[model samples]
Target chain A: MERVLDMTIQEVRELLRKKEISSVELTGFYLERIKKYDGSLLTYLRVTEEEALEMARDADRRIGQGEDGPLLGIPLGIKDIFCTKGIETTCASRILEGFVPPYDATVIKKLKDRSFVHLGRLNMDEFAMGSSTENSAFQTTKNPWDLSRIPGGSSGGSASAVAAGLCAAALGTDTGGSIRQPASLCGAVGMKPTYGRVSRYGLIAFASSLDQVGPLTRSVSDCAVVMNAIAGYDPMDSTSIPQPVPDYTELLGRDIKGMKIGIPREYFIEGMDEDVKRAVRESLAVFEHQGASLVDISLPHTEYAVATYYVICTAEASSNLARYDGVKYGLRIDGKDIIDMYKKTRSKGFGKEVKRRIILGTYVLSSGYYDAYYRKAGKVRTLMRRDFDEAFKACDIIVTAVSPTTAFKTGEKIDDPLTMYLSDIFTIPMNLAGLPAMSVPCGFDGSGLPIGLQIIGRPLDEGRIMQAGYVIERERAVKKIPDTLR
Target chain B: MKITKDVVEYVAHLGRLELEHDEVELYTTQLDRILDYVDALNKLDTEGIEPTSHAVPLDSVMREDEVRDSIGVDSSIRNAPERKETFFKVPPIIEVEE
Candidate 1:
């Protein structure tokens, strides 16, 4: 089991393929680990033990019939944000506590089609709102590196679980650095494709414009494997780009000689952790040695990302989350009238951070402030995208610190919404630009906390971005398995 | 303050949310700070720039309008808090004015 935990998903695939280890056994092994470790980790929202075993059983049966695929029989953790049929998807909010979807999310359906066993729904920030997992209505997921620290969120559970080997790899959503920031902090590989790259048919809408389903994986290769399965156009999602899905695994071991790696000056700013900056600075040689050129660039509108993002995301969230009025689903608090019921239910059902965003969102999109906040943010968003477009003209890929600092202590920034919002400073810009970016573990800080740098690619250039990340992952080869596991 | 307690109350009302007195007070301070912070966007010159709601330009796809399978009423209202047969049962929405 220890050896299996160390081995990549590719190796697990080989083992399952040769009938050396049945899917049931592998599923059980992961389940046992989850049982043993998750108590301390508090990563999973709920472990779908029976469902996983049944899926594994189905996979083993299919294997007997000579069926094979990339993710066949692999056990993975899923963020609760995605709607899974017959399974309750709360998105870490009290309001949707008992709401079970009648159908799987498009990405969920895609993964199900690939015969992947779900370990369970992992925890996330309520409505994927806050930066840390402390906002979860259920449990605060602790960083596996140090139990005192938070696993960076809102995909904190997914990254923490994957890092601790609770699941081989996990699915997470990145609206504003939910995937990459957590993945970076936890030393797991997380990839967020371009905005329209993945289908969001059944993903609980956060900021519809910014929300994207992505993978947090054990390795860069595993990230690619999962991406290959989940990336494609779905008719159900209008925003999903109707483009051919590339085989992401094709450039696993390929050389990236002469590749231009853009280092945006704006992302490497004051207030960034010195160790993080040093790690990124040191990686310059590593990239150069791997036959890549480091080019200095500037994203002028980078500073405005956090502000712009807050306005737009909140505005969209206000509109999206308005559905949870206690009428059609989840938790309900009865009141005198329908409006009163909505008021009562939402007030009680939502957490503090969720309410804060809802209020902020409503305020921005409200009659008087829409033009100044929402529309202004929208125009600035265009500027941010233009900055990326100009920079991409000279470079194939960009590298920047995934988080300004390492995983912060739980409740460290929870009280201060502005400070907590800054946790995603480095990552928010990429989301605004709608580019493919990945968090690959770079090095460790003095306290052995993992540091990561995002390898960003142009729009729909996930394959290229992944190839560069694969290179860095190989060069760094930092200790991925958390000490908690050891 | 960009957002006062009364402003928070009005916004919460518009959002159909019932905020406690403290919540309104707290949100007033926090939202003011956030709004003040976001006030930096006014510095940028976006005079002639079109607001791009989506980063990528999307062309509407021409597809045949066909009746396909839906989640159905049973599944749709299955999670409803109060369901009367297929329709979602709700509290009195239209108030009859005396």
Candidate 2:
């Protein structure tokens, strides 16, 4: 029965359908695991014990009434970034501490419609800023595989929660590799939907254009199942696409014969870990064995991705975060005057990284430097997008490493922001291009850390990446549960 | 490209953030390093390229000018740091004639 906590959402779905287990039992199992393991992992910022159990009881009643939704009663974790009605959503930052949203995020609404029980709000980088969870205003979420190492961020808690078996699956946001990078480091399957696929209405703003919601699950099929529930059009979100949502699970186990997989030369650059490169190359061969053709390709503008991403993201962040004045929601430090109030509140509320980014964003968007920095970066972003457009023309999917290296030790790169930023180099371009990408566990490094192979598809083409990922997932069906849990 | 103390101070002011003296010094050095790294963008020739605000080309997103129910004052003010009735309380903006 303890092994029930390790089952995927799909497996749990069948168990509920067969009446072998009630939703209450399954939810309680995960809640118990979270209670036992979460103290060391620091995966959950808040465990919605009452809400989750109450929802589970309702789910059990629905199951008894013959309800047949895939996510019915499945316990999952929500990233602190998304608004849950009456649930505190702090975006792992002090600025939003103790703030509970009055309304549910659109994603939360959709999942609730499917009767998915949320375990709690998972920890993340402060306002989804840094690469490692160390930037969290609360406790750092450690990697489930190696306790001393960091679980990647800003969705570190989501990945770690799933990997630690604390939740059946978890929801995360990826503005710049927040979902996939952490998924890779934690050895879970994570998929970032196309930018506008999932509505961001209740999501805490980080860089409006780049921010996207995704799922980190134990398997690709589970990712597809979660996507089916969360992905679609929404009138509430201005950026939500009107395209019809497909049954993401429909494309699973589809034949990949004659599919062209591109290996972007620029992504395989200098200083990338040899183990990561080797593991990714080996997975390409697995795809080739599945009758897919691998072609070497180029995204020449890849070098400019990080620089452009920083400038544009920070500029937008500055504008979006300006709404958090002294009078508004969350933290407020009163001062002698209004101006002083705003300054004091912000300076005291935001973490060091958040403040640094605000300063950088302000400088870039300021009167004197807007043209040289912001506009130029935006233009370079166009060039980077063009590189993807050209490369995608020759391939069905692009294969690359999610990050240059696996999980680094905690406090290793927290002080060096540049090196920390570079950790998401490979995953950043896909976000900038608004394409769907998935990170699937490929193999392990010498230190037994998991390496992730990134599968990138064109905009609105999550099906293709899932189809390709399904094959790799089948061939390399290695159990990656950390020894800590065992 | 050299981010000096004045530049850091001015940026912090524009960002509406108060920085202590040590923070200013620390930020100046850190920003200098990051800005120097980001200077790599200047190497590319983006002469005629149009800046892309969004990855996808979205037409003007306009909804019908119809009234809809909002969360209203109570729920909206639930998270306010300081609230009075239905309004969020804040420091006064006007300067009295002394």
Candidate 3:
């Protein structure tokens, strides 16, 4: 029975088809695990036991009736950043502590339609600000691999839940590597689809242009199943691309023979932790053994990625976060006047990192500095995109490390904001280029911490990216549950 | 470049955040450090390049403005700390000098 917790989504589906397990039984099993193990993990902010059981029962009824979706009866842990109808979508901020959203995010709607049980909302960095879950105003989510160590975030809770077997899978948002970084640290498969590939209608805004909703699952194939459900046009999200979403599962076992994979030279340079380099190098060998040729490519503008990302993301964050003032919705601090009220509300509501970003964003967008900082960052972003565009011409997919290092201990870099920001060094470039990217667990460090290998695909080409990731994941044979978690 | 306390205060005001004296000092130093690190961008030559905003090329996606019934009103105000007559109540903001 415990082995069911370690099974992949496809395996669970197969078991259900064989009548070896029922949806109600699986949901109950996960719910029981959440009860027993969640106290130490702190992964879930709120568990929707009643709602989940009701949904699971409905899925069981559907299974009894011969109707099934790929995600039928699968339980998913949702990051609190996405609005779920009647569920508190806090973004792990006090401002929205008890606020229940009246609507569902487009992805949530799609998952519900597929009969995926809502396991619960997971914690995240307040407004998805920091790389570690310690930034979450509510509670810090510990890495399943090492309870004392930090779970890379702002999707820490989601990654931890999936890694700890608290849930079958989870959804996370990536605004500059939130999904992939945490996925890497927790040894789970995470994918950030091409920008505009998934709708952002119900996702709480945080650096709008770079923000994207993605999946955190146990395997690359499971990620494909989740992506198939969520990726499509949504009338509510204007930025959503009106393109046809292909059946991702169709390409699951497809051949990667003769695939031209790009290895970016800049990604393997100095400042990367030696363990990460070794793991990624070994993973590359697996691809070679699989008959995929690696081409050395250069993205010259890669050096400017982090700088451009901070400037542009902060500028957009400053604007999007402005809607949270005390008046219309969220937390409101009382003051003598409107100005004082706004100040008090925001000051009390936001964390230090959030405030810091807002100030930086406001400064960059201010009249005198707009052209120098904000506008200039935009121009550099163009060059960064061109770098990827040129690289993609020679290879079908680009490979790199997800983060410079694996998850650091909690409080290791919290006070030092620059060091914390540097954690996302390899990830920001893909967001700037609007390319689809995925992080697959490739190897473990000396301390037994997980390391992820990132795969970047051309715009709207998530199929090839997932294909490559699945191939690598299978060939590497590096899948191992962390001892601390078991 | 060293960020001054005055600049921090001014930026905080612009961002609608109220910072205590200690917070201002703290952020001033932190922001300065981050700015210095990111200032590596200034060394790059981007003289004639066009700024890129959206990652994928997308044009403006405008929609027709149409009137619709509002929903979620009950849940929107469910967490309000203070509500009177179904509206959030706050301190008066009328200017007294006028």
True contacts kept of each: 0.91, 0.88, 0.72
lDDT of 2 by residue, A108-135 (tens): 9999999989889999999899899898
Which is the winner by DockQ between candidate 1 and candidate 2? 1
| Listed models, DockQ each | 0.87, 0.86, 0.65
Sliding window of 10 residues with minimal summed lDDT for model 1 chain A: A477-486
Residue A7, candidate 3: alpha-carbon lDDT: 74
- C-alpha lDDT of candidate 2 relative to the true structure: 0.91
Whichever of 1 and 3 has more TM-score, that candidate is 1
- For residues A1-486, write the lDDT of model 3, one tens digit per residue: 578766778889888777788988999999998998889889999999999999989988898898867889988899999988888788888777777878888999999889999989998988999899999998999998888888899999999999888999999999899999999999999999999999999999998889999999988888988999999988787778999999887787788899999998889767789999999999888888888999999999887777888888889999999987887668888887888998999999998888989999998898888988898888888888888889989999989999889889988999988878878989988888778999999999998899999999988889988888888788776664665555
lDDT for each residue of candidate 1 in A1-486, tens digit (9 for 90 to 100): 577887888898999899999999999999999899999999998999999999999999999899999888999999999999999899999999999999999999999999999899999999998778999999999999999999999999999999998899999999999999999999999999999889998999899988888999978889889999999888888888999998999988889899998988888778888999999988877889999998999999888999999999999998998998998899999998888899999999999998999899998998978999999999999999899889988999999999989989987888789989988998898788888889999999999999988888988999888888887788888898876587
**Residue pairs in steric clash, candidate 1?**
none
TM-score of 3: 0.96
In candidate 3, the residue pairs with backbone N, CA or C atoms under 3 Å apart (3 or more residues apart, or in different chains) clash, namely A378-B51, A378-B52, A379-B51
Two-chain DockQ for model 1: 0.87
Q: Which candidate ranks first by DockQ, i.e. highest?
A: 1
DockQ of 2: 0.86
Separately for all candidates shown, the number of backbone clashes (residues 3 or more apart, or on different chains) is 0, 0, 3
RMSD of 3: 1.8
